[model samples]
Target: MSYQLQDLLYLMQRLRSPEGGCPWDRAQNFASIVPHTLEEVYEVVDAIEREDWGHLKGELGDLFFQVIFYAQLAQEEGRFDFHDILDALVVKLLRRHPHVFPNAELYQSLEAAPPVSMEEVGQLWEAIKHTERAEEAPHQPTRHLADIPTSLPGLTRARKLQKRAAQVGFDWPDPSGVLDKIEEEIQELRAAIASGRQAEIQDEMGDLLFAQVNLCRHLKVDPEQALRSTNRKFERRFDFIEQQVQSAGGDWTRFSLQALDAWWRAAKEQEKKHE
Candidate 1:
């Protein structure tokens, strides 16, 4: 709490330095430490969902270290440092939020605002990307849906790609159409199964998941977070069932399909009632 942001970043970088520092930290690089970044994001989500402010504070600190770690590595390579990164973000934030800080009179309210459609807004974001790229390289926004990091988890990346494509009117209009597409994809997946071709089945499975991601967009839901919540829900309920069975001197391996189904249904009902 006493340290400023820069001071904390400095401390973290020092901790990762070669001389008299953490071995695990010093061994890490951008690509090698990706799972830590992903795990920290999930920890932040967990803390927020549980409303644990103390845990959130700790998780946020860990996440901050991840960023600073990357900056430190870049600093060593003379690519950029934390200060440069900070200055770039500050400039971009001020540019995007002209309505709040600057005297620049942006479109008056939502209604009085300059009638820039979503299509135009996407173009504006692209413009900003172009400006950033120019600063880094003389790069242009060659494609409408370009530059999304491939390293992103498939589900999240799929949603972002779908949203980007929708900006160019490449998306279905309604949830009904999305649902129908999902059914079509499911049929294709079943056919792939019947065909018994491994490569075709993999491709069909990817298509099915991609269709589901688009359906999530049409329904105005976050596919990745929805899937993660389902995972946690099952984890909690199954753990509860396991505990109860042990308390009653029952072995988990001895559970029949019907018995487990009954427990699972009870868990679902309990979850609904608690909510």
Candidate 2:
């Protein structure tokens, strides 16, 4: 028999029940579950990047369970429940996609509404979000950077902050300008290293990374995704190196730096041939 979402919610409730609940589940709180939620999110992203369709469903279910867990906790506190989460999500999505739901009505037919270009859709989405933000805090001053969560991964958050600033004409005019900024940051980083001040080195390092993220943004590339791809490539090349070492009697002492360099080049050539 096929189980439904209600079944999953029931299971969560059982796990968190005071009477006979799993101790681990009962012990967890919003703060404690955050790490697990982030891990599950990365797992979903990894599965998609690997094109692991067979396991994607399981990863998605794990991510969805995170939401259910949060909802259960909120429900227990009498704040809100899973149904409320769904209602808010549906309402927000319908509000955002005005092209699809012309009257902001979920059940409205789309036959009469004219199609919108992708660029126009993006503009409309941002405009609607801006209006929503204003309505959410009518008295508070609008701060574009304030809404971005500091908990976001550094590279992702940097890109978002840059994009937000760009909307107000506060960004590099082109990728070339970003490249120059990155070069300038690199020079400052080198100077900091020469000075041998740990604090200055760390500060310059962060600036260098932030500048690189800006370069990625100006080039229309996602810095996080680009780094992930490079990480995978590094793994593949290192695996090749390990295989070579194992073949050579598993003796790292026998191979020189030159030999390892040769193996790395060979790995690159092998990848090129596959491509």
Off by over 4 Å in 2: none
List model 1 lDDT by residue over 1-275, tens digit each. 57788787778778887888899888888899789999999899989977899889999989988888889988888999998999878777667554343443344344334555775666766666656656655555456555788988899999989987886689998989989988999999999999999999999999999999998988889988898889989998898788778987878778787887788888989899989
Clashes of 1: 0
* Pairs in steric clash, model 1: none
| True-vs-predicted CA distance for residue 127, candidate 1, Å | 5.4
Worst 10 residues of 1 by lDDT: 104-113
Write down the lDDT of every candidate, Cα atoms only: 0.82, 0.93
Q: How close is candidate 2 to the true structure, as a TM-score?
A: 0.96
The top-ranked prediction according to TM-score is 2
Off by over 4 Å in 1: 16-19, 101-127, 130-141
